[model samples]
Target: MSESAQAADPVAYIQHHLTNWSTSQPKSIADFNVLHLDVIIFSALLGGLLIFIAKKIGENLSLDNPSKLQSVAEMVVEFVNDQIKNVFPHPDKLIGPLALTVFVWVLAMNAMDLLPVDLLPSLWTGILGLFGADPSHVYLKVVPTTNLDTTLGLALCVFVLILAYNFKSKGPMGYLKMFLFHPFGKFFIPVNIVMTTIEELAKPLSLGLRLFGNLFAGELVFLLIALLTLGAGFSFGLFIWFPMQVLLDLAWLLFHLLVITLQAFIFMVLTIVYLGMADATADDH
Candidate 1:
């Protein structure tokens, strides 16, 4: 009935956190649509944090010895800027901020996984229930990348950037010419168009899947570790289970930290690469 009651049942605690705030019925295996509010809220908050951090950087910048914060910010800025500079070639006044945002925002969002997974969700859910809403519907997965909706939304944003840069760097005719003639003869225009379309479609798919799959699996592994403390102890014996469960959770979490960083980097780098591709010139080919 209450959290104290739920605390008496480990199975229910983890199960409640894992449950989705979905509208669909579980008719089959495919009936899963994890209504992940944590991902959305975390992403937006991180995005806002990125902008604020950027503003602070801009306000406090100096040529003398930099503060630790400024140095860290500069390192991230330069890293993203170097990647964009290498790929895009055009020194646009606008693209720099967007690219920097991608790098920082994603890094922040991915960093959420470093928090004790259930702590924030448990806190927020309790807070929500105080407002008279159903706490179950406040479903949260702290790692935004764990949700298909968030990752796909991010990938789609990158896709839109590609389109924007395509239009900005290449006129309508140039963009069309890219689809019609880049890889082969003009006679193969139709096939080329279809191939190019598929390639474009694959960008978001790859981006989304790469991030989503990694984080989702990582989350599941943690859930599995949580399960380890369950029936194994009650059915077998506590002596045989608790030690292995602690070791396994620690090891899995340590490994997942690397994975979360790698996935975030991969996603950001892909975004920059796609943006760079959009800004490519006909002469380069």
Candidate 2:
């Protein structure tokens, strides 16, 4: 859109930015009517990028005069291994790599927020227009972590690992005993069942919602900051908003760098903790 068009109705522009590139319109809150193409595309691209970088670093490793990329890669691997050893006492062969993947993938996804909000969308819209699609309808959201489905999907994958470890460490009967007897003993088996169910369910719910809520709020704030720069038309007074906008934008962006990294670390740490908890045998439970 032209500057005049955007300035004419900033609300519409904000709404357009918020919209997703989906397969179709959703009919209801529970409907799975449309797939978020933007999220899928960005996520796949990031995942592929991670794989490519890892492969390149692995193939180029040198003990003598290591490259910066190799050094960073080793550092990341060592950090994740230490974290896993600390939390997951009997760390499985898969745990270190899984934790590393979660940390890097999430950090990459969250890093998308650092890009100018309108950059990808405007570029995508222009490309779509050239292909005979309506530029106005080419909504694109580059941040996959900000999408609930993506976050929840990650949580669910962790949940499955929790279940697997639970079974592996405890066996079926012991697992049943975990839910049937516990904090209240055999007399309170009914309460034990209900409480245990809720506790288990809360893990994934909290995991997904925490990441989604934070990123979604950050994305909205960026949009609002962007909106502050707009006006119906040019005026001498408009210059006054620019400095405030610049200061706020820089401050928030700096703070958000910590937020993105912290969130990714938190998610990785919690996944290790949850899996460790699941690894508890009947005796420990």
For every candidate, C-alpha RMSD to the true structure in Å: 4.3, 2.0
Candidate number achieving the greatest lDDT relative to the actual structure: 2
User: What would you estimate as the lDDT of candidate 1?
Assistant: 0.74
TM-score of each: 0.79, 0.94
What does candidate 2's lDDT look like per residue over 165-210, in tens digits?
8899888998899899966999999999999999999999899999
Model 2 clash tally, residue pairs: 0
Model 1 backbone overlap count? 0
Off by over 4 Å in 1: 1-36, 125-138, 231-240, 282-285
Candidate 1 lDDT, 1-285, residue by residue in tens: 455555567667676665544554346534445444455567778888777887898898888977888998878778878877676657878668777766667667766766765677778788888998676456666767766777788899889878988988897898999899967769999999999999999999999988878877777777666665543425546767788888887898788778877787787778867877787562473
lDDT of 2 at 171: 87
